[model samples]
Target: MKKEQPSWWRPWVLPVLLVLGAIAVQELMRAQQPAPFSYSEFREAVAQGKVESVLLFPTRIDGHYKVGPGENPRTFSVVRVEDPALLEELTRHGVKVSGVVPDSPWMSIGMWLLPLGLLIFVNLARRGGSTEPGGYLAVGRSKARIYAEKDIPVRFSDVAGVDEAKEELSEVISFLQTPEKFRKLGGKIPKGVLLVGPPGTGKTLLARAVAGEAKVPFFSISGSEFVEMFVGVGAARVRDLFQQAQAQAPCIIFIDELDALGRARQAGPMPHEEREQTLNQLLVELDGFDPRIGVILMAATNRPEILDPALLRAGRFDRHVLVDRPDRGGRLAILKVHARSVPLEDPADLEALAGMTVGMVGADLANVLNEAALLAVRRNKDKVGRAELEEAVERAVAGLEKRHRVLNRLERERVAHHELGHALVGLALSGAESLRKVSIIPRGIAALGYTIQVPTEDRFLMTRQELMDRIAMLLGGRVAEELVFHEVSTGAQDDLLKATDIARSMVASYGMSESLGPVTFDDGKASPFLETGPSRVRGNYSEAIARRIDDEVRHLLEAQHARVRELLGAREAVLRKAAARLLEKETLSGEELAALVAEPGSGKPLEPPARDAA
Candidate 1:
C-alpha cells in the first residue's frame, strides 16, 4: 500500500515545528554575544583600568521607530557616565540589547497569522454544511414554545379560585385521553374552547393544566407572535405552525391574547394588513383540519368582543367559557391553596378574608398571600399571623402602609373624624353592612385614612334602593367633613369619585333616576372619547332635558348629604367619641364599633325607598 502523504495543515504538527524553530534560532542568536558579566565583575574590570565610557539605556526609549522604512533611527539611549573606566568596564559586561528583530522570521509570521487562522478555522467548523442562518439571524423566527409531555411545569393544583373553569377544561382532558369513549356515546367534542375573562384570572393556567393532565404536546404562542412586519412572514408562520400541530396529532395549541390576531376587520380607513392575513390563515387552517386528528385548540383573551365573528363561529372556538371572578367558596379555596407556601403562626382565616374580598380575582389572592409572606420575612418573624395577613391584603389592594406619613395633630384628628364619619353613616344606612375596620395609617398612592367594610354575604342582585344606599354611604365622608369643618378637603377624593361614577351610571345606564324616566341613557360601553354617551333607549330629551340630568345627579348627592347631617346631628357626641377611639386604637372591627352605634338598645332602621325613586 502507498504511504499516506503527511497533512501539512495538521494543527499539532505546525505548532510543534513553530516552537522548535523558534528555539533553534534563539540559540544561534545568543551564540553571537560575548560571555555574560555580573555587576561585581564589571566593578573589578573598572578597578583594573580596562574600562572605557559606559552606556545606559533609559526606560523611556521608543524601540518601534528603529524598524520604520525612514531616516536612520536610534534604538537605544545613554545617560551621563560617571567615568571613562566605568564605561569600558560595562562594555566587558556584555549586556545585550534587543531590537524589533526576533530569532526567526517564521516565528513572527506564525504569530501574525494565529488569530486570523483561528477565526477562519472556527468559522469553517461551525459551518457544518448548514444551509440555515446563524444563531442571531434566527431571532425573528416565531418564539412559540412547544411543551412536550415532559415539559409541563404547572398542573391543576397550581391553579386556584377557578374551580368551575378547571372542571370545564378537565372534560376536555378526558376527551383528549380517550376520544373513543366520547365518540362511542355519540358525543362530538368541541374543536376549540375560548377562555373569556378579565386579565389575570387564571385562564392560561387552566389550559396548561389540560396539557399536564392529558400528557400531550402543548404548543403555546402569543397571538401577537403570528403577525410580523414583513408582508408574508405572518401567513407563512401560521402555515408552519398548523402543519407542525397536525404532525403531532394529539396536541394543544394555546394562543394567548387571541384578540390581537382575531380582531374584527372593521370598515376603517386602513386595515392592519399583516394581522388580517394572519387571521385569514388561522381561519383557513381551523376549517381544513378535522377534530379526529386529536388536536385541540385553546385560546384565551380578555377582549372577546373584539374577535372576528367567523373565527368564533360553529366549527372554530365552538365553546365559550366565562371565567369570571370567584365566589366566596371559590375564594376560600384559593386562599387555602396559596397559604400552603407561607409560614403561618396560625392558620389563615380564609373564610373571613373571602367575605371581605368580594371582587378579588385569583391573581389578587395569590398576590395577597405573597405579600403576607414578605411582611413576615421583613420583620424576621418565624411565622405569619392573622394581623400580618390582613395588613398584607390591604397593602396589596391599596399599597404599602405609610405609617411614617407625617400629619399635624389637627390634620390627624380631621382624618380620624373623616374615616369615623364614614363608618358611622354606614351604620345608619339601612341596607349597608357594618364597617370592618377604621385606620388613620396612610396607604397606597394617596390615602390618609380608610374605613374597610365587610359584607356578611355576597350580594349579586342589588336592588335600585340598595345601590342608592351604597352611593349615600360613599358620600358620608365628604358630608361629614363639610358639616364639622365648614369646608371640604382632599380627604374625600376617592369617596367623591365613586359616588359621582355611581350616580352617573344609575342615571345614564341603569335607569335608576326617576327624573330621567324609565329609558336607558347609554349602554355603558366604556370609550376613550366620552364620559357619557347618547341614550341607548330613545327619549324625548333635548339640550334642556340633558341639563336636567346633571341637576338630578347634584340633587341626589345633596339629598344624601342632608341625610348624613341629620344622622350625625342626632349622634354628635357619639361621633366625636368614636373618632377619639379610632385615633387611640388606629383600627376597629365591625362588632367593636357596632356596640357604640347600637348604644340606644337597638340598631336604627329606615324604610326602603320605591324602585327608580331617586
Candidate 2:
C-alpha cells in the first residue's frame, strides 16, 4: 500500500511551506555588530592613499551595503562594525562610508520567494479545485446584476410616454407583487416579457419600472455580456445567472439588447459556438425557473425577430410588449412630466409643441426640452420661452447653425430671396402656415437663412391636398432662386434632399401617390439585417411604373413652383420688405410677423399661426 501524505501537505500545502521558509531565512540573516576599526591605525595608510576602497556590509552571511555617495573608491573591501564606534573609527582612518546597511540576504530571498510562493499555491489550489465534477473554472457564471426593490430608484413616474406599454406591463407588476392574486384560479403569470421597439423608445425604462413597482430584487445586464472567448462560458454564465435569480425569488432579470445574445441562427457556416451554447443555457434556465416563485424575467431589445425561437416559446418570453413612439395624447402626458422640473415661460404650450413633434420619440422630446433649457441658461434667462423652445426644436432636428462660414453680399441677397419665396408661398397656401420670419441672417449648421413657420394648431393627419401644398412649400426656395436670380444655387441642396425624401416617403411608405395606388413601397429600415420590406428587395413594379413615379414627383414639384410664383407675384413688395426686416431684426416671432404683415397695405399673412403639430 502506498504511504499516505499528511492532509496539510497535500495540494493546499504550498502557502504553509512558503511561510516557514521565509521565517527561517529571515532568522539566519539577522545583523551582528563587530569590533570598531581604529582610524589612528589606518591614518598613515589613508594619507598614502593605500586605503583605496572601503565597503560596509552588515556582519552576517548574505548581506549588502546600502550604496551611498561617500565611500573610498580605490579598494574593494567590506568591514562590519558597531554604530557609534564605527563612525569614530572611520573618521580616524580617513575612510568614508555610508550611514546604514539597507539590505540583508534573507530579505532579498524573501522578496523573490513570497510572490513566487503565492503564485505556486494559487496554481495548486486551482488544479485541486478543478478535480471536482464541475471543475474550478468560472466559465458559466452569469454577469447579470441583482438589485432589490430598495436599490431601484426608477418608478413609473420616472418614465414618460408609451401609456399602452405601461398598461400592458401593469399585469407583470401585479404578478410579482401579489402572486396569490393571479394563481388563485389556475391563472399562470407570464414567465417572461420581451419589450420591443425602436431605439430610445423607453423599453428599458418600462422594465426598470416593473422592477421598482414589484418591490423585488432586480438582476440587470446586457445580452452582449453573456458572450466570451472561451467555449461554453456564455452558457455557464446563463445557468449561473438564472440559478441566482431562482435563489433570490421575487426578482427581475432585465437583459438589454437581447438581439446580441439571442439572434436567430443562420443556415450558413456555424458561428460563435460558445455564444450558441450560452444562449441554449439561457433558454434552459428560462424554462427551469418557476414563475410562481416570484421570479419575473423582463428583457428589452429593439429587434425582436432575431431572438431564438426556443426563448420565445410559451414558457419563456411569453408576452411581447410593443413600446412604440408616443402618440398625440402620449406626447401631452410626456410633456407634462418633463415640464414639472423645468421653468417654462408659459408652461410650453404643450399641445402645440406635441403637434410640431409628430414623429419624435420620447428621447427626442426629452432632448428638445433639455436643449431649450440649455439655451435659456446660456442667454441668462430665468425660464425657457417659446422662442427658445422653437430654436431648440430646430437645432435638435436640423442641427446647430453653422454661422462661421461667411457668405458674400450677393450670395446673402440670393439666400434672402430663396427663403422669402418659401415663406411667401407657404403663407398664401390655404392649408399652410404663414411665414413667421424669413431671415437672411445665418443660423445653426449650414443654413444661410431659414423660413420658420408657426402653425396655429396641431394637425395629426394631412389630406392629399395639404400634402401637395406642403410639397409646393418645399420647392418654393429653389423655384424662387431660379425665377429671381436666373440661376439655382447649391444653397438649396438640403432643401432638395428634404423634398425628395418627403416625396419618396409619400409615394412609397404613406401610399399617397395615385399612380402607386394605396400599396406601400417602403422597406421600413428598422433593422440592419432584416430584409422583409421594399428596402430588403426591389419590388416587381415595372420600369414604366418607376418612370411614372418620377414623373409624378416632378409634376408635384412643378405645380408647387407655379403656385409659389403666382403667390409671390402678388406679394413682391411684402417679400422684399419682410426680407429687409428679417435682416434688420435677425429674428421674429409669429405675432411680430403678423403685425408686420397686417400693416394696413401689407399682404395678409397665413392663417393665424396654427398650433404646432404632434
Candidate 3:
C-alpha cells in the first residue's frame, strides 16, 4: 500500500516559520543600520575636514564622512557625549547638522504584533488544510463516509450466502425506492434494521447491497467513532450524524459494530459516562425520527447479546436480520461469485470445493481463493488449477506447509503410521466424516502430519454414536503409536487433548453420561454467534458429581482406546502396508487409503464395530 502524504501545512510549520521570520527581520534591520563610530573617531574626522554632515539626537549622533571625489560618502553613528566643544568643532568645520526626534514606541509594538499575526495565519492555514470531517476543530462532526447513489457499485447480485437476509432487506429497499407504496396502507416501515451475525459473515456487505439496490445515498460509520475522551462529544456527534442523514433523505445509514456504542449501560462506581451519553442520544434519535421520512437506519454487530435492551425494543430496531454463514449451496454460490475474476484452468469443481469447506465464512472462502491465486503465481502458473485450490484449502485448514522442516527416518515412519491410523479408523467408522486425504508431510506450526475429513453435508446436531466415533478417530493416532511401537509418542499430544475435550463435553454438557442422567451442568450462556471454545460448567452440581463426571470421561476414552486397539490389531497387516506406502509417498488420497485398507491379510474383512455403552 502507498503511504499517505503529509498535509502541506503542519503544526510544526508555525514554529519554523516564526523562527525564520525572526532571523530575516533581524538581518534586515542589521543591514539597514549605519556602522558605529567612536566619539574620538568622530572628533578626528571633524578635525581632518572629512565629516560632511551630522544628525544629532538625544542619545546618538549620525554622520556621513567624505570619501574619494568619485565615490559616495560612508555613513556612521556615534553615542552622544557631554562635550561642550562638540558643537563648536562642528561649527568651525562648517558641517551641515540637523536635530532628529527619538524613535516611536509603535515600532516595538509592531515587532510583537508581527509574530502574533504570523501565528494566526499559520493556525488558519492548518485548519484550512484539514479537509477531513474528523479534524480537530470538527471533533463533534460525524466521521461517516458518505457514498452517493452513483458511487455504490455493490448490488444484491454481488452479495451471496445470506439470501434470507437479502430477502428481508428487500422490503427496506422497496420502501426507500418508493415510500408511497408503504404509506398507502398506513404501514410503517421498520425504523432500524439490525444485522446480527458472526464476524466475516458479510453484514456490512449486505447493508451496502441494500443501499445499492435502492439507488440511494449510503452513510457508513463505526459505532466507536461516536465516543471520545471528552464527555458529551459522543452525544454531539450522534446528533450531527442523524442531522446529516435526514438532510440526505431516502438514504441508508449503516453503523458497523454497534456494540461499541450501544452496549448495556452499567450502574457502577466507575461508569463510562461518554459512552452512556452517546447511547442515550442514539436512542433519542431513533425514537424521534419518523419512519415515513425515508431515512432508514441500519447497524451490524457480531455481539448482539451485549447490546442495550432499549436499543433493540419495538420502536427502535424492530427488525433483526441474521446474516449467518453460508451452507453448502450458499458456499457454492459464494465461490462462484468470488471466482468471477480468477482465471481457472478448467472451471474448477466449485461444488466439491464448497463441500470440503464446511464451516468457512465468506471471508474465509475469499481468502482461500486468494491464497490459491498467490500459490499459482509463485509456481509460475498462468492459471489457478485444481491442485493449487486443493493446496490452498490445506494451507487454510492445516496452515502453511513447512517444507523446510525435515524429519528424521524414525520420525517420518512414526508420522506416516499416525496419519494412516486416523484415515483407517475414519473410513471404518460409519459415523465419522469421510476422509479427504492423509499426509505425513509436516505443515503448520507443529503438525508433523494431518488428516483431512470433509463432512458429506452440514449437520447441526450430532448423535451420541457420531460423537463417540469422532473421539475414537481422534485417539487413533495415540492408539496406533502404542500398538505399533509398543509405546506412545508426544506426536499424539494434540489428539489426546481433543479427544479428552469431546469426552468431557459428552459427559458434562451433552448429558450423555448415564450416571449424570439428563441434567446439564454447563451454564450455556456463551454468545451463540461466537466460537468461545468449551462451555463453562456451572457450580450447581456437587463435588461428588464432578468427580463422577471426570471418571466417566476417563472411562469413555479408555473404552474407545481399547476398541481402537482391537480394530487396529485385526487389520495389522493392512496397517503395515498402508503405512509403508504412506512413508514412501508422504501422501495418500482417500481412495488410495481405502483400497490399501481393503487388501486381503491374515485378518478378516473389516466391519463397523458395534456401538459400545459408555
Candidate 4:
C-alpha cells in the first residue's frame, strides 16, 4: 500500500498564512491610531485657535486639533504640562476643552499578544489534526510502539514456560517467514491469534518472541490507547493502525490489554459512545486486513471472557491460544532460563525450587531470580546461594520478613508450639504437603512463626479426602494450643481464616455439601479480572438455605477441629517435646521436626490412637 503524502500546504503553510493575516490586521489597525503630541504643542494649538474639542484626563488629553484655522482637525493625544494656567490658556485661546475624564491605560503587551496566541492556536490545531472527521488528528493516530527487527532482542529461546503457546505461535511465525510454504499447502494464514491467559503469564512476551522469530516489524500497543474522549477518534485510530500495518507487511500488531477496547458492547444502542465506535472500527479493520499479505494481528488479554463476541469471532481473532500459568516443569525451564546469567554459589536445585512454585507464571519465576540476586547483594554476598533463593521465594509468597519484631518469651514459645503443631499434623497426613522449614522467627506482618510446606509433586486434582486433610492440618495449631494451654491465642487467626475459606469453598463453590446436594451455591456469573466475584454469593438459594450453608460450614470446621484435637491428644508427649526444642532452637528443619515427632524406638509413622473404650 502506497502511503499518502501529506498535502504540500499542510503544517507550515497554515501557520504562515495565519501569521501574515494577523500582521495585515495589525498594520491596518495601526494606520488609524491617534498621534501623540507634547502638552506645550497642544497649548500652542489651543492658543492659535486651531483646537476643535478636547477630552481632558487627570494627566493626559485627547481631542481633534488643526494646524490652520477653519481646517479639519486631526485626532491627537497629549500629556499635561506642569504649568497651572494650561486650562486658562486653553479658555483664552477660544478652545472648547471638556472637563476632566478618566480613561484606563492601554497598548499593553497582553492586549496585542492575546489575539496572536489565539490565531496561532487555531491554525496549529487545524494543521495538527489528522485527516479525521472534524479534524481530530493526533487523537486518531495509533499509539503503537514500533520496534524494528534489531530493536527486539527477545527470541523464542528467551521465552520459557507456556510451551504450548509457543508451539501455537510457531505457525504464525512460519507463515510470516515463508508464506509460500503454506500457500502451496492450500493453507491461508490465520488473520489473528488471540492470546488468552492470566496476568504475568507472558502473553506480550510471547507475541514479541513471535515477531523476533519471524523477523518482522513489531507494532505494540495497549487497547486503552485506541479509545479517546472524542467520538469517532477511536474509529479513526483503528483505521490508521491497520493502514500502517499494511504498509509494513510481514509485521506483528500486538495489542496488549485488549479487553479495555474490545469489551462486549452493551445490549442497548450506544451509537454515540467513543468506545462503541472504536470497537466497530476495530472489527472492520480485523475483517478487512489480509493475513496473506503478511500482516498478522495478535492480541493479549487476561479477561477473555469480557471481550466483545464480534472481536473473537471466526474472521477476526479465530485462533485463541491460552497462555495459562506454568506448571512445575515449565517453571523449572523458566527458572533455568532466567538464572543463566546469575553467578551461583551452591545454587538451589531448580527442580526442587520449581516444585515449590507449582503455579508460578514465567514472569513470576523471573522476578524470583531477580529478587534472589538483589537479596544476596543486600546481604553482602558475592553470589546467589540456595538459602538466598529460598528466602526470596518465601518473600515472594509470604512477603518480606519482619525480623526486628521481637516477641516476648511466652509468646515466642507459644508460637513455636503453634508452628510445630502444623508441621506434626502435616507429617501425619498422607495427602498433606511435605515440610520444608519451620521457624519461630517472625516473618511478614501477621505471621509470628510459620511452617513452610513444600509439595513433593504438583497435583492438579485433589480428592475430597485430600481437602479434608488440608483442613485438619490448618486446625492443628489451634488444637495444640487448646490441648497444652487450655486456651488458644490469636496466632491461629490466619490458620482459621484459611481453614474457614477452604470449608466455605467446598460447600458454596465445590458443591460438596450433602444437604445442598450436588448443586453449587455460587451464582457462576463471570467476574472481570478476579478469580470469582465475592459479591454475588448465596444466590439460587434461600435465607433458609443460607442458614443451612452457615450450619454446614460451621459443622465442617467443628469436625476438622475435633479430628485435630484427637490427633494432638494421642501425640501430646511428642508435641510438648517438639515445642520445648523449638523454643531452644528458635527454628527447625523438616528432618529435625520429623525426628522430634518420631517414635521413641522406631522410625515408623506416629501410630493412630488405640480404640476408645467406654
C-alpha TM-score for every candidate: 0.73, 0.71, 0.80, 0.82
Winner by lDDT between candidate 3 and candidate 2? 3
Off by over 4 Å in 1: 1-141, 183-187, 524-545, 598-613
Could you tell which candidate, 3 or 4, scores higher by lDDT?
Answer: 3
Q: Give the TM-score of candidate 3.
A: 0.80
Q: Which residue segments of model 2 deviate by more than 4 Å?
A: 1-140, 269-275, 305-313, 343-358, 381-391, 401-405, 432-437, 454-460, 516-518, 523-537, 540-548, 594-614
Alpha carbon lDDT of each predicted model: 0.74, 0.72, 0.88, 0.81
- What C-alpha lDDT does candidate 3 achieve relative to the native structure? 0.88
Q: Write candidate 4's Cα lDDT for 1-614 as tens digits.
A: 99888776665665667768978998999777786777777767777777878878777778876557675557888776577887787777777778653444564566667776776777666666754434434666777889999998999898888889899889898899989999997898778899998888888999999999999999999998988787787888888889988989989999999989988888685553789889988888887777789999999998887788888888889999988878887898898898899888854677767987877788778898899899989999989988888888988887778879988888987888888789888888776377888888877768888888887776778866778788888999999888888899988888887888888878888888887878787776555435652343457878998888889989888988888788888787888888888888877989988776674843345654332210
Give the top-scoring candidate (TM-score): 4
Give the clashing residue pairs of candidate 4, or none.
129-137, 130-137
Q: How many steric overlaps are in each model, in order?
A: 7, 32, 0, 2
Find the candidate with the highest lDDT and give its number. Answer: 3
Off by over 4 Å in 3: 1-135, 535-542
Q: Give the lowest summed-lDDT range of ten residues in model 2.
A: 605-614
